[model samples]
Target chain A: MDLENQKRVKDLTEEYGPENVVVLLGAAEGEASGIAAETVTAGDPTYAGPLTGVSLGLVVYHVCEDEVKEEFDPDVYDEQVSMMEMVLDIDEIAEEMQAIREEYTKY
Target chain B: MKGAGYILVHTPDMITHYGTTQTSERIVNPESEYLKNIEANLRPYERVRAYYPNQTYIGNITPLELKEIEGPWQDLECPVDERYGKYGEIMPQDEFYLLIQAVDEFELVFLEKSFVEATKPKLEQDPIITPYVLGRIKEGVESERIDDMVASEDAEGLYMGDKLVGAVKKAHAFDPNLSAHVMVENLVSKASSALALMYAVKNAGIDRDEVEYTIECSEEACGDMNQRGGGNFAKGIAEIAELSRSTGSDVRGFCAAPAHAVLVAAGLVKAGIFKTVAVVAGGSTAKLGMNGKDHVKKGLPILEDVLGGFAVIISENDGVNPELNTDVVGWHSVGTGSAPQNVIASLTTDALDKVGLKVTDVDYYSPEMQNPDITKPAGAGDVPTANLKMIGALAVRRGDIDRKELNAFVEKHGLPGYAPTQGHIPSGVPFMGHARDGILSGEMNRVMIVGKGSLFLGRMTNLFDGVSFLMEPNSGPKEEAAGVSTDEIRRIIAQSLRDFASGLVEAGE
Candidate 1:
């Protein structure tokens, strides 16, 4: 995850309280998406830069995950993120996001 | 013996406008939300001077002094005209602008005639820039040329007090690597690093000509399209700093570069390869306003406004200054798992174990010392404090300290974060000047300097990188002939001969 994005996630979690925040990741790779999800839910697993040891424990989901896709307006999701979704392995990304959220997310 | 002297230079003016985050954002979207909020939060030179961390950075105040002050340092002011510090100085943006032009050998940087005329006198007053260096500044061109270049040639305009004062022209026609913005960023790194080198030479009380080798370890890469990361920042910085005798190269490991470079310098000195080696790095404009959006949103001052540069002179054992003990350097190996516990252990306990020392033995630990005022608002929390906690936890795991004593251990060995998050700037090297002072004054026996980097950012490998080494008071000068006098050698030889004769007699009997 980008260091600035990590900061934003942490700031937003603090501002709205962790229970109110939900991180939506858009990484094409499962590992990348999982890492971003884990950074917000747990701390940065990579132990790199600012997010190291900073566990916000916020709810997180990948854009390709069904839970997130279901929340979006069907036409809007199809119009915006549908093209990239075809190339990405949705199952792999969704599974990784689920795994991270289950292990680390507190709310 | 290693690490003869050290100095750190802070350039607060380059942060907001030139930092990579702001510049890259502006390039992608000129009307970005971050850019809109930047101007309002941009800190003036006066406020930056008054900021406690800035004062501590320049050595205007000590770390302890900064710790004693109240929270939200932006609200508190410690106004002073002094720009110099025991280690280095906090240079204003105006003089730094002149320096960028002065150090520009490629003619990429151009200043407005009136702006130069107005600022040259002030720059001339700087004690570090000798007349020979001052003469390097070219007479400025008209604002018409700057305006034309910015409009047609895609030059990045240089601003002072919101007034167009100069511009940096792109070096290549279409190569993104040599774009005007990149050139300005690289030049800023080079010039600020050179300023740091100048201070290092001055503070070390050595002639610039005595420096034989320089290693630039900044995050910036100086290269064209063919070899995108090809670099010679070391020689580039040396040239501007008037280190005529210095030959050098660049080392890149993201934030870990400084620790690597410093270790390499120490090795070179210890091996008698070089009498004096200087590890120098300039600040990144790209990182200047890295957390500006967060600071702005939080109604806090843009704390990431400083471009940080530092130079450490490593020479053959001086018998007085603190020596870098390279015998037991900590390294995060290729196979080291990327777990936080693993990273901290590799950099702290693993290294200490090699020297038969425990975590509690090190008087101080300097690791990513990013100022909390800047990072806390940015949601990074206190970076140094986080690192210290990890180290402390490791200590508890190793039975070096009890869990109940963790806070006390952290308070004793850790310093408050004060360095700007200029990538390599904050990594372990910031406390070197203080460590040197502490060792010399007998206040501290040893300090561990650790640098950690995220290699995944480069997309090459997921493996993390880190290195650490100890700086301790020199154990006096090495004696001639390994401390064995000729008379002692002769006496030993005689004693051995007598013993041999007695043994022969016994055997014969």
Candidate 2:
């Protein structure tokens, strides 16, 4: 994640309280999605961004995950995200998000 | 007033075969997946020509045209035949390759005999290239000589359709900075900048001889080993463009260099140091495929395939063109925080405060105009939109706009990011040509150009850098200064006092 987004996540978590915030990531690759999920929850794994050592432990999910997908209107989801869904390796992305959530998501 | 010209050189071969990202990755991992996928993802010249954003870049179509056309521009059908635009042209790769050699003064670039013979005529036909420039393309060397250098002399091969058409030889035996790869990259920058400068002169209706000075603000640095960044890119570009009366120097500030150079140019003109100053920048080979991995991973076309170049000619305000407001310039000091909001405030409100103008008073705000198509797949988000939102948030904080009006403010003031992610090229400078026209035509009253740089990229400083200035319709020609010197005034005052004393003595007698 870029520094601006990192700052935004941190600010939003502080503003609304950690329990109310959830990050929906739309990265193409499992690893990138996982890294971003880890960044918001466990601080930046790369140790190079604003989130470093400031773990929010907020809830996070990849947009490809079933938990996030079910919340969207099916028609809207199909219209907006179905093409990307067809190309993505959802199982890998979901597994990464689940792993990060299991390890670090306190809220 | 400053006349801006911009061009995009579609160098797919350069992106795939020689871009620093690809070449560096190849050296580290020759069979990288991105490299393997490159050949399949490369867009043909025809598709590149028809891409909507590209059409806008070369001025073949207006930004408003995109609003009517449904896009994902890659999938949009835009049949454009003309490569030229109001600002400049979108040059194809083959002609650009010949230009790269044409601009070379060191004879370091060698082209295959057959390839040059075939491409020379096409290059000669471009109106931008004068006969003098066309004559600069060397009679081609034998293919064997180029191939042997690539195999034995560490020369970087230039390829077209898998055939080696040219090679750039290393300038030194052991100097990494003077290596063949670096030479090729610098030559590309020089060539593209020269082309843009030529267009700027042509578009502005100014004689080439009128360009008295040039400031090159590209990210590329040209020099030998002893002085790695010791640059005369401005002079090199001037030489190629044949700006006979111009002398120049380079200014480097990462992505913010163009804004800085433009301000510097404006100041020079305002100070009467130069009657006309062209601030020019060429594209970077390193930046060509900077985001390829992200695009390729997402099953998207490699949109960062084109190198971007721009030239802006700053002249004495003619009372008709938009005047660059040097008085209300913004600077991001070392003390300024690097937070997004802070940076935006520094660039927008801080400068606006000087002129007693509210954020809403400005007609448009152009920040980092990085094409979202390129940045979004790379996980950078919509950069221009993000910038506008920050500026909008700042407006809300200052009560210049209500919180509910933030979105509307953004919608009104923001422009879509259409520029290539060529670092300095996208940093609030790309829209200058449009802004000039909009102001001149009374469509816009004021537009601010903001440039932001990441100083941390150099590892020399943690401070962020930025500069901004407003462009508004010229108020009118400035009143000329009174001619009398202070010494002359003093002498006249003393003479009047003496006369008064003599008159008083005469009257008393």
Candidate 3:
């Protein structure tokens, strides 16, 4: 398990109360929707810094055109991680997210 | 009357070789834990005769081969499950594909037999071998016929054979729509299992017009979410069965569909309404290996594999067996209690009370409970075993049977083999085929096929779990005739009604 997903599990357990909930995530998406949006593995960048009793999730921006699809790099989806970083990285993360979002819209 | 005629079904062989197990704890698919539990608890038929060895194959449902969407999902993506906020994380179609993977899909678990054969050309023939026919062939000329069939130059001749042909003809005469062909299906997802069952029935030679009712018990889903079994399958299946619309149309119950279907068949038989009733189902393959990853990732033993399908034909003729405990009672953890505690006790006590069988009298109790050894450590909490214990506790509490008797009961029943953890399919139905035998043989009097579904997980509020039960044929009055021929009875009733109406009219005037 990735540190991130493993951490998310811990967080969800505490947040929902283990007895009341099981760890479930709608991981897949479709055009304008989540395709097979069933589940995601533990290490996906979607969850970060979740610990002890905190549940966390990442909202993906849909950049729906083919031309825009070319501009995205899977490796750079670091907003969740940056959110946990010291205050300094917030602007950079936010800026990058905006740029990525803007680029997808062009297509 | 043929004592509760038992139909023992095993997952199609091709399926086991390639099928996957549904691992989720929820009971969304009909083949979830509840269904599996009933299967596990049912007794096996000792007199084994394989019928309809040929499998029926349905059409392919392969998705339009995935194409990269012209644009990113953001432009085209549809609103998705809230839990997944937009992340241009993956391909749009993959998202839909994977989302379906998570739930207990009906089509993926059970496959149609002919579907399997359709995939493999060499196994071209689909045969429906009944118990009586299997017995006669086995005793009379199986080897010789096999040789003759093998010797035939044409595959059709081989399969449609002089011997096989005769048998098929005989079956066709009895049920003219009966196809001597066996049905099979390839694994896609669990829903195919249910589809396969429907496909089998329709393909088996039961004309759509002759079929007054089509009871579906298998867990395959014909519809996507929201639509719910709304597909051309009814048409596809009807075409396969060659049935027409006037014959009527409908499905019954939740997971206990097959059992419900049987009761319907029995009722039709008893009520003198319909003569032939067919219970058919297809399981999904999607649930396949749902838990394999959890086990493999955690380094534990793998629990379930491929999905399968089955179809049973119930008729009123003395040719088939009849179940006596028609007084079948079903209950769930409703009104009287809550989870963990009430769920167990209420369901058990209520079912037992109906037949006046103490925990001791019930040959076995089926609760689509999880297999403790396989599920306990996964934080599942040993639901099946706990269910058994609850039954014991109830018996002791009621002063019906003592603790020693409880131990004896468990000992006699034994923990069934580990089943797929899919909440519904694995529950009480898996062992039903076997338990049915004991009922027919008179070795066991009252056996209950119980099913329970947990609704809370689906996030569908206001819906509590549901439970249903079915009793197999046990002993009853020998030759307890129907009292009157159904046709004649209907005719007489019609005449009496006409006279009564005329008399009333005259009195009014």
Candidate 4:
């Protein structure tokens, strides 16, 4: 690893704040994503193609039960699934979203 | 703009790991160590097997053509990491019983064994509810056979779970109750995902009201890829959960949604307009794609899982989880991102630039944690792990850190593989909750949470990829300038909010 690239990233960060900086994730899937990547990264000399990500699913969520139906009855199982309520509280961001939801519902 | 005020880390209720091994044949209790291991992983959270009404043929749509399946999928051709193909291209696909996980209540110290499993299970072997319901509906309509799908607003008698459950029941027009005992788990995959997410909130002690926004990330096939019917019908799952109150929008960003979600939460909090935002994602077991039985006959384990789900809460409020660096630098900058190749460069550098931290300053980088073993079964090679290595190498190249150091970072902090290849579920950002916990406990400082979405995978043209990193310090709560009670604070803010609304109303004129 060389300090030159580090400084380049450093200077770029200074010029563009963290919110505005665009570090390309070198995930090269084909089709539109490939074209977009080429247009964005290859089009710009500053674009960094090599990138990475973490598989957070294993960390945050886990399999509580697999192969559920072999022993369980689907009718009994679905009843339980329905009995349990699924709720998402949006009041937290109600201020900005009230209008959008109303519009979406109208659509 | 500034650091999050209070961050909370939740021990997941359960890590519902499902293995891919079932064949298309209607095998009864077949033996496969992979299948056994999957069952072993899901033993914690109360797993639900919901019977989705009008599933059509989710239970028996095994693509049996690609026959001649065999051993573990990883043992097949193109085992290398670079091979790219839609996972569903493989086969031996069988009926998928979507599994969902959640902790009954909030708790930390993630020893998943202590987590309670969701009791909701999907469709059982016998699925005869549709005929029964159609008979019931015949009492009112002239035709016993349904001419239009539930989407037809004019259809007199309709039954799909939603807010109209009460109205439908009173009218006796729809009956999900008749086929009872012969349960058929509906493709309520999103609900399964949400069930697991609620645990992240409660176990982490996140207040439902504290969450100002919820960013839901799932596959392009979510709600069946159709605009209207995809949302959990009749159930009004989104509203019942109260994901949005008077504020917030349902952000649909494909696989990159989880990352996009967290960034949205962070943005709202940083702007001081909101206090909390939770980025949530659900699972879809039916994406068994076109592979399934075809792969099974071809000797590949069934890539579809019976269950799995994950969620992370990001907030500016205190007492829930450790706050991520509120200073966001780059967001794949729309037209300036790559597919998966450039995910790291765009994500890592963007955040580092905000705090003036170089690539090496990133104590660690985490990416698509897709298990190669699972993905290979689906025809999508080792994509997740490949992203991780790329970032580690990038750290070394920048001279910001050494190759050994970066390698050590991944080796030590990297999560043990467990999640099923549930498309958007096992993405890079899922680890943020646990990593944030580790960071606060002095395990590390500044973890880079990079998330990216594949818009092209959904066949959407003019679409672009999105990636962003959430940076956090390895320390405890930071001191604030002053203190105020929540009620008083809410009142004060509400007054301003009321004024802001009034202004918007006036301006609209």
Pick by TM-score: which candidate is best? 2
lDDT by residue for model 4 (B1-509), tens = 11111111111111111111232111423553433443333211111111110010011111111012232333344112210011110110111111111110111001111111111112122121122212212112222222232224222221211111101111112332211110112223444444444444543444455555555555523222224224322122233344444144456666676677677777777677776665555545334322343344345434343334455655554422355666754467665534322455667765677777776566555566554445544434455444555555555556656755855645543433323455665566645644554454556676666666667655665555666665665233334313546674465345434533542343233
Ranking by TM-score: 2, 1, 4, 3
The TM-score of candidate 1 is 0.79
TM-score of chain A of each: 0.93, 0.96, 0.22, 0.23
Q: For model 1, how does the per-residue alpha-carbon lDDT over B1-509 read when each residue is reduced to its tens digit?
A: 22222333334445546776666666656776667767777777767766778767766566766667766677777754356665567777878888888888888999999888888999887778888778988889998999999889689988875677889999988999999989988998888888888877866656788899999999888899999989998998898888999999999999999999999998888888988999999878888778776677678877777778888888876555678888779999987766566788889889899889989899889999888887766645677877887788777766788878988887888888888888898899888877776676688898999999988888899888999999988776575235555675565345434533542353233
TM-score of each: 0.79, 0.81, 0.48, 0.48
* Model 4 lDDT tens row, A1-107: 01243345445645764345443311122222222222222221112212112111110100111222334575654333211111111122232232322332121
Please report the TM-score between candidate 4 and the true structure: 0.48
Q: Flag clash pairs in model 2.
A: none
Predicted candidate 3 versus true structure: per-residue lDDT over A1-107, tens digit per residue = 23344555556655875455423221111211121111121122222223322322222233322233346463332211111121122333334344433432222
Distance from true position, residue B283, model 3, in Å? 2.0
Best by lDDT: 2
Q: What's the DockQ of model 1?
A: 0.04
DockQ of each: 0.04, 0.05, 0.02, 0.01
Better model by lDDT: candidate 2 vs candidate 3: 2
In candidate 2, stretches whose alpha carbon ends up further than 4 angstroms from where it belongs are: A1-34, A37-99, A103-107, B67-71, B480-509
Which model is ahead, 2 or 4, in terms of TM-score?
2
On TM-score, who's better, 1 or 3?
A: 1
